[model samples]
Target: MLVRKMDSEVLVLATDNRGKIVELTDLLKPYHLRVLSTKDLLLPDPEETGSTFIANAKIKALTAAQASGIPAMADDSGFSVAALEAAPGIYSARWAGPQKDFNLAMQLVHYKMIISKSDDTQAWFTCALALAWPDGYCESVEGYVYGRVVWPPRGDNGFGYDSMFVPDGKNMETFGECNINRKKLISHRADAFSRLVNRCFKGRNFDGKRLLSFRQK
Candidate 1:
């Protein structure tokens, strides 16, 4: 089937999370697209019923794309510890409970690791990105950044479990401790987003120069 061309430049991001909106908007800065979040449009969030990151991302993307009659993008990401056998792989956010208190969630993770009596600190963050058109056509990709979990959670820069994750090869600085530019350089979201852009936006008539102009505004 022939995929419909994206005639509109506006792309709705299917998420209400402010942190995600900021990260995604920053990532898409180079593209000649106007980004809008579900919160900005006051769109209802679709339930993430999928079993995996890719599936969940597709659900959000398709829902927003169809609802707004425009192309949309969504991201589903999580933190998994090797010792826990990735218990919170998909339920990372749920671990924070209804309050969305990630501090409590981090404490829970540390507690679980202690109860398990496993010394393994090996962990990883996974990100899945999905891009969907109004007609339901979609593309999805996943990326990962392997690292080890730290104790006493350091830094206060990033959201979620960033304070505890120290990506491999970094100078022992947790994501929360690193500046946004440094974190973006090796983040799972950045890896997946790069692939998505290459797959969907490359070779298009997107004006690269507009990125500079948009930033200036």
Candidate 2:
């Protein structure tokens, strides 16, 4: 059954990435959630020792929920290149080093691709979203968007590998070239968020602007 309305309830986002915070905040705006980030609460990020995206997301969410005594949401996302055997999958951020220099990371990808001499430029982005309650209950979902990699990473609109990725259906515009709203419409994160909303936020009534109430499922 669908849970009761979460009107004005607090939801802590278990991430410190400014880009992610902006995107997620925008996606969650309709729910009227009083969103806070781990940075805001002065909570230290838990070590993400999981092997997969979902596992990592769950770890972060559960850790934040436990620490804050409130519901928490987290997402672990990355870029994977088929030619590289999906390398840098879970270590996408690590590839950027401590400075979080994604430009260096993107350059590394291009360098690896060149040295490997792989004709295939196919790649994809993966995102896993997890929501956890203070009681230890948690749920997760994964989403993906496939496309090819582009060199000389174009545009500056997005953070991370957005410049190096051109999602399917987008004429040649890299994610960095597209605006946030346009990117949100078809991003891997958006896909995951949509699934989450369908599963958890289902039965909620929306009269265009405001959410009325949640219907019993």
Candidate 3:
């Protein structure tokens, strides 16, 4: 009896960010699972009280799973600058303010660096993903991609600080200069997704062994 799985694979994407939704939808499409965004379900956004990306991601994922009675996925991601001592780490989104005007945020970052007379433009983008089940089981993975800050922000391909970020080893192309496909190949989110796919999505198990093979590496 080749009993097939019905609508048992519906997963709620616990995010309202269209960029993340698009990226995740493409990444998860191969699984043939129904992925719904928070907007699609009209779910109230949860307040993030966590001090770290991983913690925030878990909070969102758990909230979605509990509220929707379905498996939920969420990611917390941001840019951290070495010169500014990671000032905008968890506050990346907040820095953009309610209007989500990243141009203002990028200017702030640039101003901080210039005022501090800091030459260390080194920075990195990090992403933490959490997958939660309705039964209260959850798994998480994090990833980072190093880069340098750029001024006179270029391109308009990506949203947020993309225009001001110059990723390493990519011909000095900022994320905004690269298309979605190019960005996916060298993004912190992609790194996190790779580990997540292996750790949890591979078996779709909440009790699976915690895989740290791709963390902070």
Candidate 4:
């Protein structure tokens, strides 16, 4: 069973990516929870030695919660391409090199697929979210979205591999080309968040739009 203790309004969000922060903040704003970034707290980044997304998320959440002495939440997301046998699943960030140049990373994926002549460009995005309390309580949830890889990339809106990822059934719009609202609705993070809300936040109203506030007293 999933649960969130209602004692604290301050929750640390453990990520340095501003895009992720903005998206998460927008989604969580309705709950009236005060979300603080690791940067805001001057928290150090935890080493993601985990071999999986869930493990990485747990490592981050727990690290932040223990360091900041507050409740913390973290997420790990990545692209898993069928052709590459999920080559970049856990190494998604590392694949971009130290500078985080995703263009090179995307090119790497594109070439590997081409060289293999793997007609199947099928892929999916996976996101794992973990929430941890300072006293050691923790919970995690995962979500995914299936899609196909597109070559040469397109659009300039999103970061990472967004420009080359076209969700299934879509003719031409990569996530980068789509509007923020559309992307958010079908994103892996949103899917994970829905589960997180259902499991942890019992009785709260979340209709995927405006969230009505309900708190445990």
Highest lDDT among the candidates is held by which one? Answer: 2
Candidate 1 has its poorest 10 consecutive residues by lDDT at 208-217
CA-RMSD of model 1: 5.1
Q: What tens-digit string does per-residue lDDT give for candidate 4 at 1-217?
A: 3256424567799998988898788778766777899999998998999988999999999999999998888999999999899879989988899999999999999989989888998999999999898877888999998898998899988888899999877457998897888888888999998888766664543342322333343
**Per-residue lDDT of model 2, residues 1-217, tens digit only:** 6543333267999999999999999998877678999999999999999999999999999999999998899999999998899988999999999999999999999999999899999999999999888878787889998999999999999999999999887378999999899889999999999988876666554433334434454
User: What TM-score would every model get versus the actual structure?
Assistant: 0.92, 0.92, 0.89, 0.91
Candidate 1, superposed: residue stretches over 4 Å from native? 1-7, 206-217
**Ten residues in sequence with the least summed lDDT for candidate 4:** 208-217
Point out the worst 10-residue segment of candidate 2 by lDDT: 205-214
| Preferred candidate (lDDT higher): 1 or 2 | 2
The whole-model lDDT of each prediction reads 0.87, 0.89, 0.84, 0.85
TM-score, cand. 3 vs. native: 0.89
- Compare candidates 3 and 4 on TM-score and give the better one: 4
Q: Candidate 3, which ten residues in sequence have the lowest lDDT sum? A: 208-217
lDDT of 1: 0.87
Model 3 lDDT at residue 210? 33
In model 2, which regions exceed 4 Å deviation?
Answer: 1-8, 205-217
Q: Candidate 3, residues 1-217: lDDT per residue as tens digits?
A: 1111112468899999988998889887767677898899899999999989999999999999999998899999999999999879999999998999899999999999998898999999999999887777788889898999998999998887889899888388899888899888788999999888866555433433332322321
